[model samples]
Target chain A: DVKVTQSSRYLVKRTGEKVFLECVQDMDHENMFWYRQDPGLGLRLIYFSYDVKMKEKGDIPEGYSVSREKKERFSLILESASTNQTSMYLCASTLRGGQGPKEQYFGPGTRLTVT
Target chain B: DQQVKQNSPSLSVQEGRISILNCDYTNSMFDYFLWYKKYPAEGPTFLISISSIKDKNEDGRFTVFLNKSAKHLSLHIVPSQPGDSAVYFCAAMTSGSARQLTFGSGTQLTVLP
Candidate 1:
């Protein structure tokens, strides 16, 4: 079975604090992504990595950063956590060499609360 | 601007009936559409998908229909079950462009027995 696991199921951080959320996948997928889910906003991509040490900013990358130093691990960093950053963070992975639509497998998600 | 939109925020249907969820996209570059089902405290899971080249794709009790001209897609669940109730999101992606998916706000579906 394919599995994507997050570092934490729930997290609480203070404003202006630096926070990191980690994700690991056993599928050996070449692409990984980070998204934040909010009510009425669905899921907004924050960052993605298609290869180790390569990162690309997504639609909502402000105040967020990502690291992909290893193939199986991806980490999302909040430069300075703010209340507005409180949301459910999701990590997803998909195989690289696919012609048609590729399916993304997601982790259970990390619910972060910033105070 | 939301490239994909699920206008209906919620939908209620009776068990054993069909449930149709609609989605619309504004980007003409999109070549693929996908639907995901998400439960509370869990990440969304891939439900069904349709390629731009095809109009309809079916898998078991789920079928996805795509209309290229209208840039619209719909997912139909036959004989909806209680376990089928969840928030469904519609997503679209452009070919050869980072493979990043643009998602909709999502529609909460309820299957009442």
Candidate 2:
């Protein structure tokens, strides 16, 4: 079975501190995404990368940045953590070929709390 | 505006009854719809999917129906069981090459015996 591994399942950070959440997929999928999920709002994409070193901004890209240095790993970074940014973060990967291969596999989310 | 919407935040059903989960979308360009089931801490998993070309798709006890005219889709679970309780999310993707999916706010389903 394909596995998507997250660096941390729970993270606690101080306000204004920088935080990094790492994700690695073993299936060699070319597309990787980062999203933040809140109570009422659903999973909102922060950023996504279709290929190594190529990234695109999603709807909610205001406070988050992402890195995809290698094909298997994608990382989400919070420049300055804030209280409002405290939420569950998820990483997903999909096979990169074309439209029909767009099935996404998600990682166990990381819940972050900014104090 | 939310591109996709799941109006019901929660739904309760008897264990042996059918549970219907509904979802609507405002985007006309969306051509593919998918349903995902999520447990408490684990990430959402893909349960079933239907392309815009087909109105209905079934996998075992789960069936997904799509209506393009109304811009709506629904998932029906037959003989709902306690183990089937979870949050369900409906997602849509347009026919473009990149294929980015837009998701609706999930609906929590509870099955009682």
State which candidate has the highest lDDT: 1
| Residue pairs clashing, model 1 | none
Q: What TM-score between 0 and 1 does chain B of candidate 2 receive?
A: 0.97
TM-score of chain B of 1: 0.98
Candidate DockQ values, in order, are: 0.83, 0.67
> How does candidate 1 fare on TM-score?
0.98
Q: Is the docking of candidate 2 incorrect, acceptable, medium or high quality?
A: medium
Question: What tens-digit string does per-residue lDDT give for candidate 1 at A14-43?
Answer: 999999999999999999999999999999
- What are the per-residue Cα lDDT tens digits for candidate 1 across B1-113? 88999999999999999999999999999999999999998889999888899999999999999999998899999989999999999999888976789999999999999
Error of 2 at B45 (Å): 0.2
